[model samples]
Target: MEKFSTHTGIAVPLRQSNVDTDQIIPAVYLKRITKTGFDDALFASWRKNDDFVLNREPYRQGSVLVAGPDFGTGSSREHAVWALRDYGFKVVISSRFADIFRGNSGKQGLLAAQVEQSDVELIWKRIEEEPGTEVTVDLESRTVTVGSLTVPFQIDDYTRWRLTEGLDDIGLTLQHEEDISAYEARRPAWLPRTLPART
Candidate 1:
């Protein structure tokens, strides 16, 4: 996971709503065990249409995605977040997001900002009218700003802290390495160290 502070980049406007994990990275792409190489699978179905926002010039390079309401619905697969990150999306702004997807995004260091529907619409219009215009997401300030428009968003303090510090679940656990080592050293010899090996 990478630290997320302030990001300013072109915003890709995804006008459709109810975008589920299946649409994000089709289930067929889940066979691989590796964490990466899912970028090509992100929005695999939508990419087939040449007119899709992501397939357009400038939008293809966008690192921020401004989507409609009910984004990231259905399924609790963390791969959705991985696909988004692999596709170069640092932040996803929408009016609403599925609870599981939002949680997954936080764990993966991807900022999932929920703004008012009006603000989402404004962002989509701005970016669509002027492709490649930069949008800035300031996690520290909990705000998203585009041109003269600025909107405040809400995020739990813990998740914000984790992302700001680049601490994933493993990273968080590692912080207590010394304590864990001390506990392990105190284990008694009476406890079976390992099960008897089977022939």
Candidate 2:
């Protein structure tokens, strides 16, 4: 996971609400084994329309996504988060997000910003009105700023700390490596210990 303190980039407004996991990456693309190359599969169906927000110029290169209410609402596929990251969006702002999707986003270093409905509309307007304008998402200050409007958002303290530190579950565990190694050294030899790697 990457540290997310502050990010400033073009904002793409996705007006659709209730975007599901299947629509996000589509189940067809899930068969691939790799975790980081799902960009082409993101919004795969919608992109075919040629006029989808993500398929348009400027918005196609946006790194920040401003979406409508109930933005991420559907299944618990972590691939949805992966697709968004691979598609180059560092932050996704919306009025509401499904709990599962929000959790996945946090673990994968994608900021799922929850704001009021009015704020979501305001941000969407700004992005759509100024196609290539930049929006700044500051995790430290818990705010999203674009043009003359700035809105504050809420995220749990622990998740915020983890994101700012760039520590995923594995990264957090590795921080206790010294203690883990010490405990392993003290283990008795007759406890049916596991074998070492064959390498």
Instruction: Give the Cα error of residue 27 in candidate 2, in Å.
Output: 0.6
Q: For this target, which candidate reaches the highest TM-score against the unseen true structure?
A: 1
- Error in Å for residue 178 of model 1: 12
**Top lDDT prediction, candidate number:** 1
- CA lDDT of each candidate? 0.92, 0.89
Tens-digit lDDT track of model 2 for 116-164 = 9898888877877879989999999999999888999989998999999
User: How does candidate 2 fare on TM-score?
Assistant: 0.85
The reply for model 1, stretches above 4 Å from the true place, is: 171-199
Q: Name every residue pair that clashes in candidate 1.
A: none
Which pairs, if any, clash in model 2?
none
User: Per-residue lDDT for 48 in model 2?
Assistant: 97
Model 2 residue 142 lDDT?
Answer: 98
